[model samples]
Target: MESLHGKVVLITGASSGIGRAAAELLSSKGAKIIVNYLSNKKGAIETVQRIQKNGGDAIIIQADVTIKEQVNAMVEQALASFGKIDILINNAAGGIRQSTFMDASEELWEETYRLNINSVLLCSQAVLTHMIPRKEGKIINISSTAARIGGAGESIHYAASKGALNTMTIGMAKELIEYGIIVNGIAPGMVETPFHEKFAPNEDRLSRMSATIPIKRVAQPIEIAETIAFLASDASNYILGEIINVSGGR
Candidate 1:
């Protein structure tokens, strides 16, 4: 594995799930972590405590990544603490609610758009200001396999938003690689995260969903985190403008 020693990583919505797992795993590999969260202060604190307990360096900051001003302030604070941000993981996002195209309201569409794509746009732009000057950085966006499969019937809006993210990842990578910055995305399939608890909730439905995956089971958060770690390291320098599918052959 490539050493992340001394690298400063800022992960958005890191209070729980894949974000938290990525922060912990990266910290174990020697990176200092900036844990960002909008709510769930308790979970964020717990993540930091776990890292500190394991002899890692980390701090927490709360920000609504979808808001430009808040995103700017969050990046400023991270810079103030670490002096330089070597990597940015755009992991803050949600599907909000599940609804078919016919039942999806305008409000739901707009809200999903803001959460899924707007957050990535604001966070990536905010960090580029610093990464550009140094001509070195890595940006990893957490997308979904839904972007490619179009998601289930109840999540058309969410799937559409993620499809946009995939396009943005490619566009940004193409535009930023000349500046020595690498931009990429991870499109994950079914995973055991609170996302399912909040949206699908029914254990039977989740079980059925898991059976459909070629792997015969959903992934763990750490499994996806491993991929994120690889992208953050120099080992992936030759790769860019690509959305890596971490799905178990869905």
Candidate 2:
């Protein structure tokens, strides 16, 4: 992959999982990373430390993507620090717990949409102000396999949220293409992140869930990060508005 040296990349949810991995990987390739974390200060700091240890430039910022003011401040901070925003990885998301459609409450559904879909829209809109003038940018939305194949035990609301993200990616890609901003998405399947521990809770059930995948294993965070780095780099210039499934062939 081509180096992202000198590029300013903003990644939400950089406290852990695929977001953290992507921050480290992209920074290693010379991209200046803005590590945005919602609450995991320690994890986010460690992510920055890892990048700095490897001679990469990175800074940690705290923000709740679902909040418009926080999202605006995050983009402003990134631009203030880097002077330009080259890429955005909308990886921050919430509401991973499983719930049936009938059982899911209105609050749960609204929260899912707020975090997953609304955040993407807010962040993308914030970044566009800077990107449009420059006439160049890359926006990568982190979706999930649930959006493609509906989650069986999980709330339909979560799937609907991600489905909305996929739709936004397609629509934004078409709208932003004219301004040279490429929008794309990455849908991962059963990645071994702290998210599973929080969502599944039961170790035995999690193991059973892992067994269903064709690969017979869950993906490591770096596995998904590698794909995001590729999409953010020059190598994926021709790829826009497409959702790349990182499901281990499931």
lDDT of the candidates, in the order given: 0.94, 0.90
Instruction: Return the TM-score for candidate 1, rounded to 2 decimals.
Output: 0.99
lDDT string for model 2 (121-237, tens) is 899899899999999999999999988788747657887898999999999999999999999999999888888768877888888988889988889999999999999999999
Give TM per candidate.
0.99, 0.97
**Candidate 1: lDDT over CA atoms?**
0.94
Where is the poorest 10-residue window by lDDT in model 2?
148-157
Query: For residues 1-250, what per-residue lDDT tens digits would candidate 1 score against the true structure?
Result: 6789999999998999999999999999999999999989999999999999999999999999889999999999999999999999999889998998999999999999999999998999999999999999999999999998898659989999999999999999999999999999999998888887787788898888888899899999999999999999989999998899998999
Q: List the pairs of residues colliding in candidate 2.
A: none
